[model samples]
Target chain A: MKSLSLKNLAKTYFDAYKGEHVTAIRDVSLEVPAGEFVSIVGPSGCGKSTILNMVAGFIPHSGGEILVGGTPVKGPGPDRGVVFQSFALFPWKTVLDNVGFGPKMRGVPKAERDAIAREYLALAGLSHAADRYPNELSGGMQQRVGVVRALANEPDVLLMDEPFASVDAQTRMTLQDELSRIWEERRPTVVFITHDVPEAVFLANRVVVLSKGKVLAEVEVPISRPRVWDRLVADDEFKDLSNQVLALVRSA
Target chain B: MERTSRISAALIFIAPLAVLVALWAVVVPVFGVRPQIFPSVPAVGRAGLDSILDGSLLRHVAASVSRVAIGTVLAVLVAVPLGILMGVSRGVSAFLTPLMRFFSVLAGIAWIPIATLWFGYGFGAIVFVIFNAVFFVVAYNTLLGVSTIPMTLRHAAASLGAGRQAMLTDVLLPGALPNIVTGIRTGLGFAWRGLIAAEMIATDVGLGYMLFVARDFYQTEVIVLGMIVIGTLWLLIDRLILVPLERATIERWGLVSA
Candidate 1:
């Protein structure tokens, strides 16, 4: 059964200055099941991020509706945590504060909020740099803080919009391992959006390939946990999945 | 640059001014000008001593500083919240932008003539002029700051469960801080100039009025002294207060990288 439902979602951008209306997404719909890691891979500007943004309540749908766990999304709440492509950590806030931001907004007491932040810090392997600002950290370290910040809230759904796209290849692999560790410990309804084929295949339980604002395919992986990048890179199954995703995206 | 390097660079700025001062000292006697038109530097120094000896210098400085302080604090108090509110609402911002622009252009010196007419040339009038100057600049800067924040950032905050106030404090204010600080600095610049002009016309005892009165007696020493005091005071404000405040906010924001 699906945990989150998307029905005929549509979005448009109205350019008042130029007196033109451009449609960004048109009646795109899909369902994400509970406790499953789903990855959406597509060409850039295929309205992939727009779908996630709609579900996350960042932008209003021009048509149809999106429901999270049977409840129609009106606006973003503390129940859904998001990690962005740019790391989006508050520059003025230290690592600890950024991680703890959700709870802080929810009016969690300082002592409890600090404790929750610390727990997530350890989980994300960023406990040592809790006091550092986002600018002071390396790209990987900044992304680690972003992950911890999302995890600290422990929302029903984890929305990732190209969270690893900016990091180097080596750091990306390490982050993928850490992401697997987090998902294993606490299985949330995860929807990861990316334009990277290998990235989507490497971590997702099911890969949803999109083309022109439509779902081209959803392929499930029977791969096991503690997946090693080296072994996966050499595996026939990984290569087949990667090629399939690559072709799907390339065709799109 | 490193911290020490930045400090040295700041100190290096003083060299040009020192040279300018030396040239002015030498040029005054080169033309053999009368003391009535342009007093010797030492005569201006003597005038400074007389003002200090009578205790009026401290009183005037203290009065002007307090008025500016009070006016600026009040302006910041009111402008920031209104600016934030305007930023939050699309309809409101659209409607208010024209009105705010109208007022911002009319800030400072433009308001002095009318301000004195309303409050009758005293502390109230001067403070009001300063208040309007600071208020409009800050409000406009805040609006610009809040508007310039990438919609992606605000959306990111919302998706992460930031409610109205949290979204404001987290995304809006931090994002707008650099602009707000800049606005304050610029506003204070206009306000300082307005204060001097307003004091000249509206008050009997202020730095501007003192200079104007000294001019009646051909006391070139006092006029030059007043100009020096005005220049030095504004420099101190810009250097010691406004510049640091703006730099700190921009640094924390990372909007403008070092």
Candidate 2:
């Protein structure tokens, strides 16, 4: 069974102010097998985030369904975790507490949840920041905490909506490498959304190109792991896949 | 270093008041101001010392402080929960907002006549005025606070598997706290003024009563003493308590730099 599946999902809303119907996404279907990394790339208003929100169950699809581990998603649950573009770290909570929040919500015991939070914080290279508040950290560090926070829930699938878009180029590259390393270790089925083409090609097992709220292409990246920035850029296979994804984005 | 900074901060507050006192001491006698209009600084000080020796000053201070403490505490306890309930539902908040605004604006001294009639003279009337003054303003501010929380933060909490109770304790309460504290500060300002006014009309053993009674004999020294007490008390409450609380809440819960 596919780890995460969107079966002909569609989202439509009436713009009450404008007095017209708006279709954000339509007829979108994709299956992400367990432990696979898929990146969805599109233009700014192409509804990439709308589709991701649907999968995370933050919004109900106007038509069709989303399933995680073959169970239909009724609403947001522990089975699917989301890392938002805003980082969304609770400002009042320390880094440790923010990471521990998911398990605490799930009724995990204090000692056990604290230990789990510490473990994930260490994995994200943020154990040193356990006592620090979210605002005290830099943007890149905050996003890493955001990622580990979702990971701490032990979800079957992780949904990311432009998680790296706000950081600088150097920080973005470092975060990509860190994310790739984490994904390799945890192997949770992932669906990442972004407008950065090279970033899509670099991080995803398969790139799902979106244009005007529709899936334009799903190109496979056969560039072998363990993936690193400089080495991956030098490989011909990486260049070809990046070019193909870029061409599809431009043509749309 | 921390101690020096703390001492300097205290000095910063005290320096201006010291200058004001020096100016008053020199100007009052030098200008030959009539004793009936304003007492000399030494005369007011002697009146303060006499009240302290007789113990009426302590009684009046205790009565005023206790009434304020009781009314404000009761108001906060009730207002916060009701505000959260109303704020959680858009329909309820919209329906109640106008009503709350009307009542809050009508709070404090405007309620004095009705409150004195309803509760009668003394502690009941004064406390009632203080309670109404605090409740409506705090509730309105709390409603605004809870409503202002971004929807995305709530969604994130829900997706993380937070139940209704957890959401309230961990998200809603903490998120609204900065506003609640701010509300308390603002409301207390209204309540303090209302307390003095109510005490003048309805009570015989408060700072306000002391000031009012002094008017009968034209005891400028006693009146000046009462005025000094009122001003000093308000400064202590605002600077020592409310300001620090507001600062701490904003530092802890508010978004960075907000």
What CAPRI-style quality would you assign to candidate 1?
Answer: medium
Please identify model 1 stretches exceeding 4 Å from their true place: A7-29, A62-64, B1-7
* i-RMS, each model, one decimal: 1.6, 1.4
Would you estimate the TM-scores of all the predictions? Answer: 0.93, 0.97
Model 2: residues with Cα > 4 Å off, grouped in runs: B253-258
Instruction: For model 1, state the Cα shift of residue A37 in Å.
Output: 0.4
- iRMS of candidate 2, one decimal? 1.4
Best by TM-score: 2
What does the lDDT read for residue B102 in candidate 2? 85
User: Looking at model 1, how many pairs of residues clash?
Assistant: 0
All candidates' lDDT scores?
0.85, 0.89
Each predicted model: what fraction of the native A–B Cα contacts (within 8 Å) does it retain?
0.60, 0.65
What DockQ, on C-alphas, does every prediction get?
Answer: 0.64, 0.69
